[model samples]
Target: MYQSDITQFLNQLKQQKPTLEAEQRRGRSLLWDKQPVDLDERAKQQASRVEQTPYVYYQNF
Candidate 1:
């Protein structure tokens, strides 16, 4: 029981504070920005309606 307690204590300590380099390599990036989904939807709408006899940008606009 005493040996098991010591092992558990060591494991808990290791988990509390991980090193900085490991955190940086696979961590959440602070610089990431995503483009809006609406722009893609507008592009697809434009493409499909391109062949229509009357261009209808306002209907979908």
Candidate 2:
């Protein structure tokens, strides 16, 4: 069997810390994993948004 340096190091690291993978999953869930979006709520927000003028410096008299 052949193993790259990174693979071997990772295997050793996992063996040293058995709970490392679980900790990684927990951290990832905290930041990357998210709940499902509400499409209806999003649509309502979009509908309520005010349109911006093309030129902000000039004021309409």
Candidate 3:
């Protein structure tokens, strides 16, 4: 079988630290994992947003 340098390094790393994968999963969940979004809440927020004027710096007299 053929393995790239990165693959070999990863395999050796996993062997050295058996819990590395579990730790990675836990870290990923902390940052990347999220709960399901509430469509109703999102729609309400979108509907309540005010539209911005084309000329923000100029004051309308």
Best model number under TM-score: 2
Off by over 4 Å in 2: 56-61
RMSD, one per candidate, in order: 11.3, 2.3, 2.4
- When sorted by TM-score, best at the front, the candidate numbers are 2, 3, 1
**Compared with the true structure, what per-residue lDDT tens digits does model 2 show for residues 1-61?**
9999999999999999999999999999999999999999999999999987888778583
lDDT of 1 by residue, 1-61 (tens): 3568889877776688666546665464544544557988888898888455475666665
How does model 2 fare in lDDT?
Answer: 0.95
Candidate 3 displacement at residue 30 in angstroms: 3.0
Tell me the deviation in Å of residue 42 in model 1.
77
Clashing pairs in 2: none
In Å, residue 18's CA in model 1 sits off its true spot by 1.6
Q: Report lDDT (Cα) of residue 59, candidate 1.
A: 61
lDDT of each: 0.67, 0.95, 0.96
Superposed on all Cα atoms, model 2 deviates from the true structure by an RMSD in Å of 2.3
Q: Give the TM-score of candidate 2.
A: 0.69
Each prediction's TM-score against the native? 0.25, 0.69, 0.65
lDDT value, residue 29 of candidate 2: 100
